[model samples]
Target: MHLYTPHMLLAFLLLCLAGAAFPCSAAPADDGSVLYSTDFTNAEGWITNSKDRFYPEIETGRYHYLLEGGTGGYSAYTLPQKVNGQFTLEFDVTPEKTDDGSSFRFGIGTDKKDSQRGPLLMVELANKKDGRLFYLKTVSKENSLNLVGSSPSTGSSGATVRFEDNTTYHVKLTYYAADSRASIVVQQQGSPDVIFTASAPVSGKIEDLTNLYLTAIGDGTSGPQAEGYIDNIKLTLSPTHAAGDEKDAKNNKGADETPAPVITSAPATPTDEPTPVFTPGPTRTPFPLPPTPTPTQTPKSGLGFLVLLPALAGGAILAMRKYP
Candidate 1:
């Protein structure tokens, strides 16, 4: 018959302690520190182009970007300082009018001292030949216009959210500079839990520099121009870099002289609302999340083993003396 040994009991106790100290798996944290947030109460930080066609206004307690039967509109704002590593851009958008030829774009990158061109990574919401679609693009480091709108073909598989007139959506874009990758998620307010999600590799340098652009464009000969209401624009950064860092301070040098451009536009005026209609596109269903399992209490068998060790040792010593 085999006898219980002290070493065998010690091994079992160590194993149990190890399991408790280090779990096999855990989910990543989803929260981040807010670096910038705005309700659009005023256009204090934004810089609109000198051209009236691209200018936006703060009306009815929201930042309004309206393009009425025009080619394109452009508005941009430079960050107070450059950012690197991981950052997230989130905002709420209410589409007033969008059609087959309408395009709404948001871009981020380093803007040159005096030139409008720079390395940009952009997210485009538009109706493509395939149907109403959302896509991503990057202006290559070559600074060539030919490669400005070239979008990568591959992305995460999921239904695209088709925006109806006056329907609001919460959009989030997260970029990881370490891997040169980006992900986009859109959720319609008060409706679906999640509208759609897509991830793709981003091109260009993706420097942690200071420049963001909002663009609305039309095909000129197509349907009505694009118009959208934007609010609650926020920016978040990882906790590691939430505070100012050496790299950020280095980029801030000489930023005062050519700080964000001064934006001058016409007075605030409310535009007529567009008629509502059903937009034909993909039927988006919220992705199902994995069910969380309830944690069960760990067995206390290890403690029982330890208690038996002392008694067993005493018995074994006696048995050996009697046998000898």
Candidate 2:
């Protein structure tokens, strides 16, 4: 019996651990642009729906931008700056009690004029009939439209957070791409940090186009008195981590740890007899052989034979004694 030594066992274990740890390739760093930021307290480049009744106002050191339906419906703030790649847009939002089933859109993208040939990504917050916050995606391609998720209630683009009336909530939207794959992450204000992520394919050809705009769409279902507030619009680009590369790294590591199956060769068979060969021979005729005949002897009397045998034995004994 063979027993494994301590050193050999330790080496085997170390090899397994090393294979698991150092298997996959690391992802390359991201390269992109960082853009503009603003807190609309001074109402600089922002345009409101109505001048007197519905407009952006500064309160408690933060901007309170309002959007109403019918009387005051939809407000916008267009920026001169544009961005692409890994970027972040953060702001605060507070929905009013009278807010109907309207949606609030945030992030940077092209307007309706350049819809056909540019980049557009928007994160929309809309209230469903159940009063829960639902998220939607609208990418501009000749026309802007909503994208639905695998399930009916959930969005295919990003995660949504429920809104409380008159309650302030900080929101952030992140857009990044890796290996031609793009993704968005949305996180809501002051709670246990839960991140909602959505992904889609990125077109490699469209690299030069950029458009930045913020908008709010109104709904008149919850009476004509619906209202919402927006504040602290900031934009900046940062390094993005690749989603597919991360998964590849994990799978590669797992594959490296698994041992390959051993293969053994079958035993060879032995041959005892030589292989037979067929050769051509000349034709011949058979020959005959002569036969031999046997002879028979007759029996004598018993007394005569016994006497002759005794005399012959006595004479032989006497001759042997004389010679000795």
Candidate 3:
């Protein structure tokens, strides 16, 4: 029998227990912070008083900001928190249907005086007669800085965006400090992996700074009164370096540590000649066969039968046996 030592038995039991535990993976660290977030099913911390009345409500962990009809529709949010550096602003926007059109705008800056009025960096989504997405900006008192249209490289030239009624659209804005560039990306819900990226030059002290406003604006532009929903507004500050650049650096360092695969010469084929063939000698034949086997006579048992049996059997066998 074999037995395990006390230490070995304890180790084996521990190994069994460890195997039953759930496998775990290292969790990625959260490197960003939320400056403002809301699910607008109900009205909270949002102002709806303007030339175009906007009503924001919060429900089901999502915020829906309703827009009233005809001209100058906007909503503003005075975020209790603020941030600077390279930050990303993200939210979902849904437009409502009406007769007099709709527009949406979000602002970020150092102003919390009032929703309808403030000094801030603004981004506007205005629905034009052609139903295109217009990117506009307002700094200080200079409103309507169209970076696209009639302005030469001033505003985004109004990219045509396909809008669906009651549908949710994800909007993300990323700021790169080193290059002084800001990019906006948008995608529709439940769609293929299609992303639209638009970029603009960033200037006027937007990097490595602090304290600003993060807001949303809605407008009804002439044709149909538009109201939209918003949810999950997240703002994050990321490193200035591009993700690809960091990955490339890591790959170069790994290449320095690991050796490259080498190609080797193929094995040489056998070159020795086969041995010369040699003929064999003549074959031999055997003689005739014997008769079939016959039964032997039985012997009576006695006190000396066992000892005499082997001697008698050997004598009979020797009388008929032949040597090879």
Top candidate when judged by TM-score against the true structure: 1
Residue range 99-180, candidate 2, lDDT tens digits? 5655555545654312223355555555545343534243433333334321113433222235457766665554444433
The residue-by-residue lDDT of candidate 3 on 73-147, one tens digit each, is 445556565555556677777666523235455656553422234233444454544333434242322221213
Question: Which portions of model 2 miss their true places by more than 4 Å?
Answer: 1-34, 68-74, 111-119, 142-152, 156-161, 177-188, 195-197, 200-226, 238-324
* lDDT of model 3 at position 203: 37
TM-score of 2: 0.50
Lowest summed lDDT window (length 10), candidate 1? 258-267
lDDT of candidate model 3 versus the reference: 0.44
Q: Which candidate is the best by lDDT?
A: 1
Per-candidate local distance difference test:
0.54, 0.43, 0.44
lDDT of 1 by residue, 1-324 (tens): 436455555455556656644546544443456777888777676876534544345456677775533444566787887867767788887777777666666667665421224455556666444334455454435553211111111222332245567888887776655555555667778755665555445445656557766754322444456677777888877655332332343244332221111112211232354323223235533222211234454343446555655665576566556554
C-alpha root-mean-square deviation, each candidate: 14.0, 40.7, 32.3
Model 2 scores worst on lDDT over the 10 consecutive residues at 284-293
- What TM-score goes with each of the models? 0.55, 0.50, 0.49
Candidate 1 regions exceeding 4 Å error are 1-32, 50-59, 67-72, 112-118, 140-156, 216-224, 239-324
Task: Return the lDDT, model 2, position 191.
Answer: 49
